[model samples]
Target: MRHWRRIAVTLLPLLFALLHVSGVLHLQVLERLESIIYDTRLRATMPGTMDTRITIVDIDERSLERIGQWPWGRDRMARFATELLDRQQVAVLGFDVVFAEPDGSSGLASLQRLAQGPLAASPGFSEQLARLTPELDYDARFAQALQGRPVVLGYYFTSDRDGQARGVLPTPALSRDRLRGKPLRATSWQGHGSNIEVLAKAAPAAGFFNSITDSDGVVRSLPLLAEYQGQYYESLALAMLRVATGYSDLSPLYDAFSEFDHDVLSGVILAKGQSRLLLPVDPNLATLIPYRGPGDVSGGSYRYISASDVLEGRLPEASLKGQLVLVGSTAPGLVDLRVTPVGRTYPGVEAHANLLSAFLDGANVLQPNFAPDFDVLQLVVTGLLLALSLPLLTAGRAVLLSAGVLAGLVGLNLWLYQVQGLVMPLATVLVMALSAFTLNMVYGYFVESRTKRELAALFGTYVPPELVEEMLKEPERYSMDAANQELTVMFCDMRGFTALSEHMEPLQLQAMLNGVFSRLTHIIRSRRQGTIDKYMGDCVMAFWGAPVATPGHAELAVAAALEMTQAVALLNEEHHRQGLPQIGVGIGLNTGTMCVGDMGSDIRRSYTVIGDAVNLGSRLEGLSKTYGVTMVVSDTTRALAPGFIWQELDRVRVKGKAQAVTIYTPVGTEAEPLAPERQQRLATWQQLLAAYRAQEWDACTLLLRNLHAAEPGNILYSLYAGRVEALRVLPFQPDWDGATQFDTK
Candidate 1:
C-alpha cells in the first residue's frame, strides 16, 4: 500500500504537467502568475535607479493651441531642423513623423491652372519654367535645407496579401542566401504607403521607426532589420546607425542566430576593420527598448532644447558637440503616444531614450535561447526522480529530497540572473515542486481514506463522518505545541448569561447563544487579527500576535474589545423587546509576552494561550465585577493603547500574586486633563491619599469631607472617601504592605 501510494504521488504531478502541456488544462492562470512575477521584478529593479536617458521634445496642447493643428509643412520642419542643428547643436535627428508627400505650399498647381489659360501667358510661363524648373518646385527649398546633413528617411513595410514592393532599396550587404534563407523578422504592419519621395530626398540615413506591440497593446520591441525578397533592409533606427557609422558593408552572421545554453543571443555585428560591435536583437530582430521618460525638471543628465528655441538660436553649440541626439515631436496633436510597463500615455520618443540608456548603461536583457530546452530537461529530471526516489524512501526522506531539488533549481536560476544577466523563470521549477508535493499528498489521502474507520469513529462526535475521513487524509493547519511570543489577549463574558438561560428552554437557549457567537466568530475570523480560542459558554477568548506576529496587536486587541462592547449593547436592545433577557459583556484586554498555539494532546487538540499575562487578563475580567466597569485593562495594556481614553483604577494584587499590577477602567476621556474643577478635585484626592498613607487621620478625614462635598456623585471619589475612613481605625503596623488583594475571582 505504501509503495503504491508513493508511486501515485509521483504520477500526480506528471499527469498535471501532461494536462498542461497538452492544452487540456487552462494555462492562463500560470501566465497570470508570470505577469505578477514580472511586475514584482520590475518594481525591485526600478528603485534608486533610472535606466533610460530619453526625453520628450513635447508638442504639448499649448503648442498645438498656440501654433495650429499638426502636419506642419516641410519648410517649417526644415526650419525646425536648422534650429536644432545650428542653435541647440543636437547630435542626430530621427523623425517619428514621415514626410511622404511633396510640399503643396508653392503655387505650382495654380501655375499649371494659369498655364491652360491665355495662349500668350502659357507660352511665357513655359519659357520661364524651362529656365528655372528646379527652383519652381515647392519641395525644392526643403530638399535644399536637408542636403548633406544628418537626416534619415522613414518608411513602413507590410505583409498584406495584396501588398507589393513599389520602390528600390539600398544595396544589400547581407543577402537571403548568406542568412541561409532566414527572412528578416519584421513586424507585420499593414499600411497604405509612405512618403518615400520626399523622405528619401530629405534624409541620408533613417530607420523604419515602427514598433511591434504585443497582444496587450504594449510596444516592447522594434525590428532592426527586415527582409524584402532576397534583400536585407534596415529599420529606421538601424539606418540612422549605419549613416552615423558610415558603414555600408553590413553582413548577417548565421551562427549568431543560435541559442547559447538556454538563452537567445541574436545580435548585429557592425563591421569595423577587424573588430565588430554586437547590437542585441529581439525575437522579431528588434531592439528591446530601455526607456527613460522626461522626469528631469532641470535637464537631468541630458539637455533638451526646443525646436522653436533652436530656430531662435537660444541654445549653446557646445552642448550638442559629439552627442547622439534624437529629434521627435512631443506635440500632443502630433499623436506620438505609446504604452509601456511602468507608464501609460507616454511619448514614443521615450522608447528611443530607453534604448539609448540601456546601451549606455549596459542594462540590456539578454534573450534566453536555451529556455525551452532547459524547461524540458527540468520536467524530465524532476518527473523521473519523484517517480523512482519517492517509492524507495520514507515520507520524511522524500520530503527532504524534494526540498533539495527545489532549492537547487532556485539557486541555479538566481545564479544565472546574477552572474550572466539571464532571467530564467524560477516559478517553472516551483511548479515542479508543487506538482511533486501535491502528488505525494493526494496518494497518501487516497490510500489512508480507505482504512481509516477507527480514526473516523474517534472524530465523529465533534465533526461529521465525511470531515473525519478528510481529516485522516489531510490534517488541517493545526498542531499541539506551545510557542511563546508577544500577544494581545481578549476575554469577553456576558453579564446576564445565567439569568437568560434560566428563563429559556434548552432549544431557545442554544439558539440565542448560537446567534450571538456566530456573529462574533465571523468578525474575529474576518479581521484575521485573532482567533476565537473557543467559547467558554458565554465568554470569548481572543488573542493577537500569535500564529502570525501582528506588530500592532495591542491596538487591534483594544479596537476589537471596543467593537464587541458596542455590538453587545445593540444586541441587548434587540433582545429587550422580545422578552429575552438583556445581555452585556465585560471585556478585559492585556497585551504582553505570552505562549500561544495548540496545547492539548494529539487525539484531542485545542488552540489556546498559557502564560502569566493571560492569567492576569482573566483575573482583570473578574475584577470588572468589583469596579462596576464594563471594560477593564492592565497597566501593560494601557501603556500600549495610547490612542484610547483610560481612567486609572486602584492597583490590586489579584489572588496568587505578590506584585500589584495596576488595573484601569476606561471611563473615556477628559477634554481638559487640567480643567480648574478637575484639577482641584484631583489635588484634594491626592492630598487625602497622602494623609491616609502617612497615618494622619485628622488630615485625611478633612480632605475626604471636602472632596465629597465638591463631587458627591463621583463613584471613585466616594469609594476612596469610604476607604480612608476604614483605614483610619486600623492600628499602624511596621509591615503594612501597599498590595491590595482581591478576595473573589
Candidate 2:
C-alpha cells in the first residue's frame, strides 16, 4: 500500500508532461521560452563578422535625402542598376522593392496622350514630343538597363480579404500540377503585388519578397515556397540561389507516413543541368533564418553600401566586383524594417542577404519530419526517468543527474544544429526536465527537512519561555494576519470527559484540564511546531504548515498525533498515581488548502481556519470514537505522507459534504518498522473490511473473530464485530453502496 501510494505521488509530474507531449495544450509561453533559447544559442554560436560575398545596397536615410525623398525617377534607378553591373562588375543583383506601377514622374504619358489626341494636327508639337520621348521615357530606359543582366525582380504576396492582384506575376518556380495527389499545404496566398509588365519582362528572373512573421512579430523563418492559384513560387532568396547555382528546376520533397493521412514537407530539391542541391525545410516548407551576427552597418555580418554611394561611384570597383548585391531601402520612412533574431530593428533587405548567404554556405536550419516525434519521446523518457529516479537518489546525486541530462540534451541539440543543420525543439524537453528536477529538489529541501527552527519561530509563544526567547531573536518575520495557505489541520478530543468532569469541583476540574492541555500543547508545539488554535473545553485543536510553511506537513502532523497518544498515556499514569481520573484522546488529521491567520473581530479574535477541510478534520475527530480508534486521517493526508504505515479506516460521506472521503489511521512511521505479527493482522484487517463493505456478514464475522482473538485489546476489531452481528438480524436496502453516512456533525 505504501509503495503504491509513493508511485501515485510520483506520477503527478507525468500528467503535466503528457499534456505537453500530446499537444492537447499548446503552451504559448514555451514558444517564447524557445525563442529566447534559440536567440541565445544563435548569438553564442554566430561568427560575428561580415560575409564578403553578399552586399546590401541600402537606400538609407542619406540616400533618400540625396535622392529627393524616394519615388525616385526610373531613370535614376536605371542608372543605379547600370552602375553596379557595368562599372562595379557585380555577379547578380536582386531588388527587394516592387515597381508595381508605371513611372509617371517623367510626364511622358501625358505628352504621348497629347501627341495622339488634340495635338496630332500640330506638326511642331508632334515632332518635339518624339525627340523628347527618348530621354523622358524613364520606364523604358529602366527596362533597357535590366536587359541581358543577371537581375531578379522582387514582388510580394498578400492574403488580405480583398484578394486584389496588382501588376504582373512572374512564372512560378514549380506548378501545382506537379504536386498533385500530395499533401503540399505550403503557405498559400490569393493575391500578389508584383512588378510592372516591362520591369517583370526585362528581369532575367523574379521571386516574391514577402516575409512571414511569427506571433511575436519577429522574422525567425520565411517560407521558401508559397502557393498562389494552385501554383508554387520561390522566395527572393531561393530565386537568387537558383540564379547563382544555375539551377533550372525546383522540386518539392514530402515524407509520407503509412499510418497518417497527411504528409509533411521535407525539403526542396534544386536541380541544375546535372548537379542537384537538397535544402531542408520545416513542415510549413519554411527555413529558419540563419543570422550571422549583429547586423549593423559598422563591422557587422554583411557589408552595407549606401545606394547613393553606388550611384555616385564612390565605392571601389574591386570591392563590388563579383559580389551579390541586394537593393532595398533602410530609410525609416520607407518602412522596410524588420525585427530579426540578430537585430530587433533590422533592414529587411539584409534578411534576404543573410538567407542567400546561408543557402550558398549550406547552413540552412532543418526541422525534419521526425523532430516532433523525437521531442515527445525525449520529454516522456527523460521526464519519467527523472521523476521516478530523483526521489530515490540523494540530493547530490539528483543534482548530478539533472546536470548530466541537461548537458546531454543541450549538447545533442547543438550538434544537430551546428553539424547537421537540424533545428529540433529544445525548449519543451529542456523546460520539462528542468521543471521536474527543480520541483523535486525544492520539495526535498523545504518539505523533507526535519528542522523545527521555522516552526518555533511562528509558534514560540506556545512553547517553553526559554525556547520562546531563542525564537524571538528574529521576530520581525513572523506575523498573524489572515491569509490563505495549504496546511495540515488536526482536532483532538478527550473521550468521556463530561462524565469525568461531573464528579469533581469546578476549580479542581479546571486545574486538571489546564494541566492536561499544557502537557499536550507542549508536545504539539515544541516537537511538531504546530500552532494551538484554541482549547474547546476537553478538546485541543492544532495545525501544521501554517504561519510558517514546512514541507511534509501531513507527515509531521501524523507523527505528532502518534506522540500525543503516547503523551496521553503518560499523563493517565501520572493521574492514576495522583488519585485523579484518567482520560483518552481521539485525534483527526487532514491536509488541504485553508484560510489560516488571525481571523476574528476587533474586540476578540483568534488565528484559525474556516474551510471544508477544517470541517472535515473536526468530523474525522468525532468519528475516531465511533470507529474505536485513537486517530483518523483523511485520504489526502495519507497520500501525502506515504512514509507512514496506515490502516484504512472507512469511506464515508461526512455531514455537510456531498463527496465520500476515504479515511485512514497512521499505525507507525517507516523509521520504526512494523512487527511481522502486526503486519499479518493488518492484512487480515484489510480483508475483513473488504468483506464487511461487500456485505458478506458471515465472512466478515469470521475474519473479525480471528482478528479480535489475535489482538483482543483492539477496539476497532471488536467494534466491527458488533456491527456484523447487528446487520445479520437487520434488513438492509438492496442499493447500499457500503459508504457510511453521518447525518450529524
Candidate 3:
C-alpha cells in the first residue's frame, strides 16, 4: 500500500498535465467560443469594395413612350437599328427584352374573331377589339434590322415547377442531358424566345438575358449558362461575348475566379481551370451589383448615339465604321431603372457596359481554391506546435515560441493573399495559437504552484532552516525522485540530553528542546548553503549538495560546525549562570557518497541522506563523547577541506565496523593560515598517529602525554593514550591486522 501510494504521488503531475491537454472535459466550451470569435472577426474584416467592372443597358419608361408603347412597330425598330449602325458605334449590343408571342396586328380580322369568344356582347368590347386589331406588328421590322448582324435577345426562367413555356426555343449552345444526373436547383421559364421570326432571320445568335433576381434583389453573379429541355442555352451577355470572340463552346468552372483575354469565349477560365466564366455566388447564387449609374449620352466608356438624332442623320460617318451597335429604349417611362451605389434610378443597360469594361481591363477579384484548405492547415500546425513546445519549455520561453508561431502563420497568410491572389482564413490560425498558449500557461501556473505547496508541505519542518532557501529558489526540484549527488553530511546531538529530559516535565522538556533547536536551526538557515535533513529529538542531521550544488561544501560545512560549537559554549555559560543544567553538543562531519532525496511514504516525506556513509557519520558523532570533545570529522572531510587546519584525534574502528577510520578536529580560526607553533604541533600529532597505526604503543603514549601536558584539558589526546594502553594487552595472531574495534554500540 505504501509503495503504491509513493508511485501515485510520483506520477500525479504527469497525469494532471495529460488530462488538461486531452481536452475531453473543459476545452469543448473553449473551442465553441473560439469559433464564434472567428466568425465575428470574418464579418468585421469583409472588404468594402470588389475589384470587378460590369455595366447595364436600361430599357426605360421614356423610351417606351417615345418609341410608341411597349412594342414599337417593326418599321420603327428597323429605323432604330439603322441609326445605331450608321451613326453611333458600339462595341456590342445585348437585348434585355424577349418576344415570345408572334405579332398579330397585320392579321386584325382574325384577332377580332378570336376576341369575339368570352365577353363579346359586353359594353366597350367592340372598341377594345378594334384597338387591338390596329396595333403594329413590331416583329417584322425588328427581323429586317437583325439581318446579317450579331444580335442577342433576353428571356427569363421561372422558379414555379409548372411554369408556362411558350413558343419554340432557340437551338441550344450546349447539351444539358449529362447535368441531369447531379441533383441541382434549376430555373424553368414560361417562354424562351424574345423574337421568333426576327431572331431566326436577322440575328446570328440569340441568348436568354433573364436577370435571376435573388430574394434580396442583389445581382452579384450571372449564370452564363443554364439548362432547359435537355438543352443548355447561353445568356444574352454570353452570346454577345461569343460573337465578339468567335467561340462556339463555353465550359463553366465553379471554384476559381473568371478570367478573359482578347478572345472572350475561348480564353475565359474559372477557378477549376475550365474554359468558362465561373461566377462566385452565395447559397442563393446572388449578391449585390455595385453599379456606377447611367451616363449622360449613352457614351460612357462606349459610344451611345440618340435614336431620334441618328435617324435624322445628325451624326458623323467616321463614328460608326465597322462597329457593333445596340438598339434599346432609353425613355424614362420604360421602367428600365435600377438601384445601385452610385444612383437609385440608374439605367440598367450601363451594367452590361461595366461588365465589358471590367473584362477588357482584366480587373477582377479572384477567390482562390486553396483558402479553406489553408485554414485547416493553419489549425493543425498551430495546435501541433503548441502541444510539442509547451511541455518542454519555461513559461517565458513558451510564450515567446507561441508568439513566433502566430506571427509566422498570420504573415504567411497575408503574403499569399497579397502576392498570389489567395484568400485564406487568418482568424482560425490566430485563435488556435492564442488558445493553446493561454491554456498551456494556465496549466503551467497551476502545476508550479502545486509543486511549491508540495515542497512546503513535505519539507517545511523536516529539512534544515538553511535548505529552505534553496527549496524556495525553484521548489519543483524537490519533487519526487529528486536526484542524489555528492554532499557533506553533518550529525549533531546534545550530550546527556536523555538525562536532562527525564529530570523535567514533558512540556518543560519539549519547550527547552524547541528553544535550543530553534537557535541551532537559525544558525543553519542563516548560512543558506545546506539543508538540515531532520531532527531526532535534540539531534540534527544536515547535508550540503541536494536541491542546489555547492563547490566548497566541505569548507562551508566545517565553518558552520565551528560556529555552532562556539554558540553552544555561550549558551552553556548562560545556562550555568542561571543555575540551569549546561548542555553540550557533539557534531560529526563526513564528506562521502550518500543519497540525498525525498524519502518516505506519499503522505509524509523527508529530504534526507542515506547509505553506509551516513551510518559512518552517525558513528563519528557518537565518538565525539568518547573523546570528550564537541566536534569531530572523518579523514574524508579532512581531505576535502584542504585549506582548513585539522588536528589528528585517533585511528580506530567505530561500532559496527572492522576497518579503522581516522578522525580529526578543526583547530583553525578566522585567520588566513595556521601559526608556526600550531603547525609544528600538528606535525608531531601526525607522527604520533603513524606510530600508533604501526603498533608502537610506547611511542604513541609518549606523544599523547606530551600533548596532554601542553593542553591538559584536551580529552582527545587522553582518549588516544587510553586506546594505546589497551592495544598493548591484545594477543598477537598471524592474521590479525592493526585495525581496532568497538565491541559496544
Candidate 4:
C-alpha cells in the first residue's frame, strides 16, 4: 500500500503535465519556456551560410538620407524597377511593399487642378499638361514599368481596425472550389492591404508578407498560405517560389492517402506537369523559418544592395543577374523590423527571404499533427516508469536512473529533430520527468525520517513544532524535563465571551470561540513563533523561550499580544455588522524566569508552566478591565521590548507575588509615534502619578480632573479621582509607595 501510495504521489506532476499537453491547462510560462528551448535548439544548429540566388534591395538609412525620405516619387520607384529588371537582369523581382493608394508624389494632382480651375485659360497650359500627363502620372509610370514583368508584389493581411480594407487583392492561389468542401485550418485575416487595381493588374501575382508572431512576440514561422473570404492566398515566399518554378498549381497533401485525405494538410504540393515539389506545412499551414544565418549581409545570410546604390547604378552591370531580388526597406523609420530568434531587431522582409531559402533547401522543421497525442503517450510511459521504479531503488541508483531517463529523452528528441526535421514538444515531457524525480526523492527522504516525525508528534504538544524540528537536529540536548529559563508568558482572555455564552447556544458559542482562538493562535505560534501552553475556558496561556531558547522572546510575545488584540477587534467588526455583541480581548505579557517542561499526572501528562511570574501574568490580564486597556505589559516585558511606545499604567502587587511590578499598555510601535495631544496627556499623567506618590493629595486632585477631561469616560482616571477624594480626608503619610495591591488571583 505504501509503495503504491509513493508511486501515486510521484505521478502527481505527470497528471498536470498531461492536462497541459492536452490544452486542458494553459500555462503561459510553459509556453514561454518551450519557445526558449526551441530557440536555443535553432540557434545551436542553424546553417550559417549565405544564399547567393536571392538578393535584397534594401531602402536603408543611406538611401533615405541620400534620396529624400520614404514615399519618394513613384517615378523613382519606377526607375528602380526598370534598373533591376533591365540593367541588373534579375530573373524575378518581388516588392515587399504595398501601393494601396495612388501616388501624388509628382505634383500631377496640383498641375491637373490648376489646369482645370484657376489656370484653365492660361497660355498653352492645357496642351503642355496633356503632353506631360504620361510622364507626370507617377503611379501609371510605375505600373508601366512593372507591366509584363515576372514580379510578385508583397502585401499584408490585418485582423484589426474593424477589418476595413483598401485597394485590390491578387488572385488567390486556391479558390473556395479547390478545397473540395473540406475545411483547412490556416491563418485567417479579416482584411488586407493589397496593391491598387492598376498595379495589381500590371503585376497580377502577389502574396502576403505577414509573419506569424508567437505569444512572446517572436517570428518563428510564416504562413505558407492564408485564408480570406473563403479563398486561400499564398505568402510572399510561396508565391515567389511558384513564379520561379513556372507557376506550379498548388494542392494540399494530407498525411493519409484515403478519400478523406487524413483530414490534415501536411504540406502543399506544387505541380507543373512532370515537375512536382513538396512543401511541408505544420497544422497552421505554416512553415518553420529555417534561418540560414543572421538577417544582415555581414552575417552571410543574403546579399543586401542599397536602393540608392542600385538606382545610381553603383553596382556593375549584371552583378545580380539571374537572382530573385526583393525590394524592401531596412530603415527603422519604415517600421518593418521584427523580433526573431536570431536577433531582436530583425528585418521583417528577411523573414520571408528565410522562408524562401528554406523552401529551396527543403529543410522545413515542424511539429506533426500527432504531437500532442504522442506527448500524452510518452508522458504516461516515462512518468509511470519513474514513478514505480524510483521508490524501489536506493538513492544512488535512483539518481542514476533519473539522469539516464532525462539523457535518453533528450537524445531521442534531438535525434528526431536533427535527422527528420521534426520539432517534437520536449518541454512538457522533460519537466514532468524532472518533477517526478524531485517528488520521489522528497518522499523518500521524508519516509526515511519517520522516526523524527514520530518524536515530533510526541513532543510537539509540549513545545512548538518549529522547536521540535530544531530539537531533532540535536536530540540529546532537548527533552521534556523541566528547565529554568528567562521567558515571556502571556494570558489572553476574551472579555465579552461570558455574555456571549449566556445568550448563544452551545454550538454557536463553541464555533465563535474556536474561530477567535484560531486567529489568535496563528498570531502567537505562526507569526510570533511562540509555543502554546494550553487553552482554559475563554483563556489561552502561551510562553516563549522554552524548549528552544529564544533571546528575543519578550519582543515576540509583545508583538503577538498586539496582533491578538487586533484580531479580536476585527472579529468585533463582523459582530457589529451581524447585530451581535462586539467582543474584546485582554492580553497580559510578563517576562521572568520560569520552569517550562512536560509536567502533569501519569495518564494525562501535558506541557505547562507553573511559577509566580505565570500567575502574575494571569493577574495582569484581570487588571486590563479595571484600567480599561486592551493589553497590559509588565516592567520586565517593557524593558526587554524597547521597540514599542509605552504608556505607563500603574504599579501593582498581585496576590501571589510580594514584590510590586510596574505595568504599561502599549501605545503603539516605534514606527507609529504618539499624537501631540496624547503625548501631552501621557506627560500630564506622569506628573499626576508623581504628585500622588509624593502624598500631595491636593495637587493629585487637580491633575486627575484635567486627565479625566482630556479623555472622557476613562476608567483609570476615574479610579484615581476617587482614590484622591478618599485620600484627601486621611493624613499624609511618608514612606508610601503608589502600588495598587490586589488581594485576589
lDDT of 3: 0.61
How far residue 146's Cα lies from its native spot in candidate 3, in Å, is 0.8
In candidate 4, the residue pairs with backbone N, CA or C atoms under 3 Å apart (3 or more residues apart, or in different chains) clash, namely none
Candidate 1, residues 1-745, lDDT tens digits: the string is 3254466556666666656644687676665555455435543554334433333344455545555566666666667667655564545666665666666666675666666765445677777755665555646656666667876656666768876654324444357565643355544443324555545655556555667776567665666676566465667666656555655556654434444332222666777677565666655566655443332324243445465554445566645654556666656566777766655665666566556555555566544545545665676777777777765666788789888888887677656654665555555546766678767766666754454564455444533244344446633222234777778888888889899989999999999899888767655645545666778878988887654446777877777776677778888888887878888788888877788765677677666788888888888898776666788898888887777666666678887677888777654344425557766766676676566656777897788778778867766666766776787778885575544678666
Question: What is candidate 4's CA lDDT for residue 339?
Answer: 89
Q: What shift in Å separates residue 21 of candidate 1 from its native position after superposition?
A: 5.6
Report lDDT (CA) for all predictions.
0.63, 0.82, 0.61, 0.86
* Per-candidate count of clashing residue pairs (backbone under 3 Å): 26, 1, 40, 0
Runs off by more than 4 Å, candidate 1: 1-4, 18-26, 47-56, 116-138, 159-161, 164-173, 181-192, 245-248, 255-265, 292-306, 330-333, 360-362, 381-415, 442-745
Model 3's TM-score against the true structure? 0.41
lDDT of 1: 0.63
Expressed as tens digits, the lDDT of each residue in 1-745 for candidate 4 is: 3366568778999999988987899977778888998899889888898889999999999999999998778898899899999999998899898888899877889999999999998969999999999999989999999999989998899999699888889888988788758767888889889888988999998989998888889999889889998789999999998888784688888765223432458888999988889988888788788887777657689999999998898989999899998888889999999889999889888888888887788777888777778788889999999998998899899999999999998888889889998988888889999999998888778754574565687797666667688777644345577877788999998888778988899999899889988998899888888988999998999998876668899999999998887888788899889878878888888998888887888889887787888888889998999888999989999999989989898888888788989999998888888899988998999999888888898899888888878888998899888888888898868767988889986
* Candidate 3, superposed: residue stretches over 4 Å from native: 1-74, 89-91, 101-136, 176-201, 210-217, 251-315, 318-348, 361-371, 382-745
Best by lDDT: 4
Measured against the true structure, the TM-scores of the candidates, in listed sequence, are: 0.52, 0.60, 0.41, 0.60
In candidate 3 the C-alpha lDDT for residue 268 amounts to 29
Sorting all predicted structures by TM-score, with the top scorer first, yields: 2, 4, 1, 3
The digit string of per-residue lDDT tens for model 2 on 1-745 reads 2122233344556566568657887778887988888888887888877898998888899998777777789999899988998989899999999999999999999999999999999999999998999799999899999997889999999999999999888888887567646546679888899988988889859988888798888888888988888788899999988887788788877666422544467788989778989888887778888888777586388888889888788987667888888999878899988988778778888878888999998888867778878887888788778877887789899899989999999999999889988878888887777777777777666644532465454455443454455434433334466667888999999986886687888998888888888888887888887878888878899898765557878988888899889988998898789877778999989999898776668786666787989999999999998888899999999998988999998789999998999999988889999999999999998998888888899999889888878988787877787778878886766776677889898
Indicate the worst ten consecutive residues by lDDT in candidate 4: 255-264
